[model samples]
Target: MPRPEDSVWAVSVAQVASRPGQSKPIDTVFPAPAGIGDSVVGVREGADIRVVGSFDSIVDGLVFTGRFEAPVTAECTRCLKPIDPDWTVPVTAFFPYDSGACRDDRRTGHGKDDVEIVAGEDESEDVYPLSPDGAFADMESLLRDTLVEALPLQPLCREDCLGLCPQCGADLNEDPDHHHDVTDIRFAALEQLKAQLEAEQTGR
Candidate 1:
């Protein structure tokens, strides 16, 4: 069987988990986990992801407050230009000591009713499980969740992108004054009739 600490995302927290109020600083780079986002806007798998923060042990769990820096690839929603930017996301997640307690609480119907009653009033923090021995905290799911949620719904190359021309498909940012002389549809019949009469007169 594979050991929990063997995982790439696992961080050794045995010392901190020994007592409450303990602190452990985490500053390292891990490979970006899969499923962060779609191809249109996402961090590519195996990309470098830097995490800088600390884990503070509470009475029953460890709270991780950190910032994630990742390289995100996307296309501008309006201009359709390729954009690659370094995205930074702030994250706070809980790694409970007794991981099975939450499941047991729900199974026994103890906390389920209370949760449903005050679901609107409560804002639940992201919760992850520590290793069975409580020695390691795997960060794969946390990293994936944070990055996915922070991805921009509509990415833009720039704030003032002019986008493409609707009629000619020309890049408006390159030629701001580009346009077509469009005759109004309301006066189309009159203009065509006038042109036909002028042609007949010229022919006569």
Candidate 2:
């Protein structure tokens, strides 16, 4: 295991392939970097993300299957009220120890540079990378990407949130019955004509 301060989410995988039948159980927590919140709406910077699961040896490399949970803090999309929510994200990733094998395999059509995969690309590029010597696997990048993708485009406090009053910018959830008496612009001519007739009839 890497030091919590230096490589908070990196796990050593040097012995996994040798122990084929064993699966390394993983349970760790790390303070997410402050930059993580810039891409996500509800996530707080420096929040704790708890990862729990295991890495099992496959044929060539290893598979990291885990789940993570973190606190999400953001305003409700409908009412703009501050809210605290929790997100549980499931992660299933494969990191090959020797990416060169894939490059040589005719079926994979991957090149030598395929080992250094980019984020948010096709499934072909989704594989995490192991160190050249296969000593450790860094999970910080993968976890941050997963957490960002897990956020909803518009987070809501509740399914039945009443939202806010458009006219006064008041939270409608607090006063569900509140409303504005706005007349339709199409009826403005009719309303003005009725007012004029009433004024003439009253000799005003």
Candidate 3:
């Protein structure tokens, strides 16, 4: 039985470049930021993170792909109230092979999406820690960054979700009389006319 705080995983960070098909879990919550070039942004995630990823070498950095799961007790986007959503996110990222890119991409005003930050002197380091142990294995930052990437730009429960009824404040799904089906009165009158015509022809 490993205590939450005492849990630390051993990874083969340096060998990712040479040996393929390697992966590990960086389990912990920390702080960090997101972005690389001109557009960079802040990053954050749950207190604890569970990262399951496979890392291989790339020209720029270690290419990693996997899923991260954590207890996300955040407010519902609709209600703006607390709603626990066990958010499990799948991710794909490139851990800068060299920290040089992280340092080079430290300029501001490159546009929000134009730049990214791996590790810089600015911002909370806890939010975006290292990735690999010897190579900057900040599982915390990785989880947060991947989460930001995975988040839906326009999140919704459904495409056509009729949210809580504005009138009686009821969930449309729960309320039977929420959206009533209406028949046209003109059509009903025409049916009666047709019936009368048929009755006259039958002389009944």
Candidate 4:
């Protein structure tokens, strides 16, 4: 069977221009693309990113909101053991297309001399961007960023991970009592002197 993430989900703005206030179902799989790195925000590569949502044409732009889920495979932060877990989260984003007329309509009430400005930071930061020429609204960048952002910074296999032994590099979960004979750095010179004396006495 074809994995859900193997296909790209792109919608042309032209297709939805005629319809307003209508919701279109968006369900597809986002395959791991090349050069996107194996570990996105937190999701591992090759895992399928399932996107299920709808697209609607609002006044100024299009809005996409849906639930996204994927299986995650990564090494445990503490023990370095393989960890496979399911990652799921809800995603909501807006994509603004060439809507200069829409903005003008929204600003109609304001005085002619009054200029409209973006409420805060660059408007693009909050909403995804569609093609300037009103061609297609690409979902690749949004999916990559949303999935990555949903991943935990440090994923653990279990709550109480025993981790690994600092001395012998052994898994503490398996060998909790594993240890090694450690020499104190402060006594290094004395131990070297004692070894030299013992060698001289044996030679004599």
Candidate 5:
């Protein structure tokens, strides 16, 4: 296949057709998203991706896959700052079923669950791209999406996350010594009633 001018960038294949286990190829690193919040940009490294085959039949499907230890530079959960977070996903996926057979298979997580894989389509792209002409998807988009989907509805820098305090909008984790108390709206009425009762008793 055609490659870029950089010799450092190359695609390699393993002995897979012979063993019917995995077909090897060079991996690529995609770009990350802009701004804060959870992002999926793995450290760039030259690794191999293999396409595994199913034993039952030779259906037009994506082959064997694997996951690598992906190192993500993210912010610390506590400080709202960047931190190197190690994240991983099943990098290898199969467009196993052709046009008809490719059903939404969420339980297994190998095939399309909500997204649709076109039939009679070229599987040449990356696994995560809208187009996978190279059998490699854009890791940034795919992994980023996974990271966002997996993140808590409410994110924290850390478990003991010092969230923004309501009163002063300060990080509780940063300055634990600071304290504040809220006024009691409901109890204010009760206090007034108590004063009236005290006056009635004193008067009687």
Candidate 6:
């Protein structure tokens, strides 16, 4: 059986978990978990992810408040240019001391229903489970969830990208004057009829 502490994402919090009002600071790097996003816009798996934050102990759980920084790779939505940038996201999550008790309470309808309802109403913070012995808090799921939610759906290299020309697929940013002289469709039939009359007069 693998130990919880053996995991790379696990952080030992036994010192702070012993009592309320204690705090533990964390400043370290962990590998990015898989499935943060897709090829279009995402952080690569195994990329370095920096976490800077602290865990504060409360009566029921530990509250982690910090920032996550990772390398994000994406393409510009308008121009289709490749872009790689560092993305920073603020995160706050709860590592409950007794997750099983909370689950049992919900199942049996026997404890703290009002408290649970009030907690559920505030969707800003996320909740995760600590190790069975409450000695370690694994952050794999939290990191994945945070980064995934923070990914931009429509990423851009620049705000005012001109994109590609519709007629010839030319880069509008590179060639601002590039264009085609297109005759109006409404005048096409009349132009053809006038040409035919001229041709017939010449033949006659």
CA lDDT of each prediction against the hidden true structure? 0.86, 0.73, 0.48, 0.66, 0.42, 0.87
| Strongest candidate by TM-score | 6
Which lDDT tens digits does candidate 5 get at residues 1-204?
633222222222222322323445434443334322334323333223222222111223444344433455554544456556555555434334333334333334454523243322335443322122332223334344443444444334577776666787777777887778876898999989999999999999
Global Cα lDDT for candidate 1: 0.86
Task: Report residue 147 deviation for candidate 4 (angstroms).
Answer: 2.0
- Cand. 2 TM to true fold: 0.81
Q: Which candidate is the best by lDDT?
A: 6
Clashing pairs in 1: none
How much lDDT does candidate 3 score? 0.48
Question: What C-alpha lDDT, on a 0 to 100 scale, does residue 96 get in candidate 6?
Answer: 76
Model 5, position 174: C-alpha lDDT score:
70
Name the 10 consecutive residues with the lowest summed lDDT in model 6. Answer: 113-122
Expressed as tens digits, the lDDT of each residue in 1-204 for candidate 4 is 643233365665566743657677877787654333344224655558788888877645667778887776677778888876777789777765545554664457442221222222135454677766555667777777766666676778898998988877898888777888999999999999999999999999
lDDT per residue as tens, model 1, 21-119? 899999999999999899899999999999999999875668898999999999998888899999889988888777465456545766664334223
Instruction: Give me the displacement of residue 17 in model 6, in angstroms.
Output: 0.9
- Model 6: per-residue lDDT, tens digit, 97-193? 8866655666676657433642662345588888999999999999999999999999999889888888888888888888999999999999999
Each candidate's TM vs. the true structure?
Answer: 0.85, 0.81, 0.45, 0.67, 0.43, 0.87
Q: Rank the candidate models, highest TM-score first.
A: 6, 1, 2, 4, 3, 5
After the best TM-score superposition of candidate 5, give how far the Cα of residue 183 lies from its true spot, in angstroms. Answer: 3.7
- Superposition error at 35 for model 2 (Å): 3.9
Badly placed stretches (over 4 Å) of model 1 are 100-125, 199-204
Pairs with steric clashes in candidate 6: none
Model 4 accuracy (lDDT, Cα): 0.66
Better of 2 and 6 by TM-score: 6
Candidate 5 ranges with C-alpha deviation above 4 Å: 1-19, 25-28, 32-62, 68-84, 96-152, 187-204
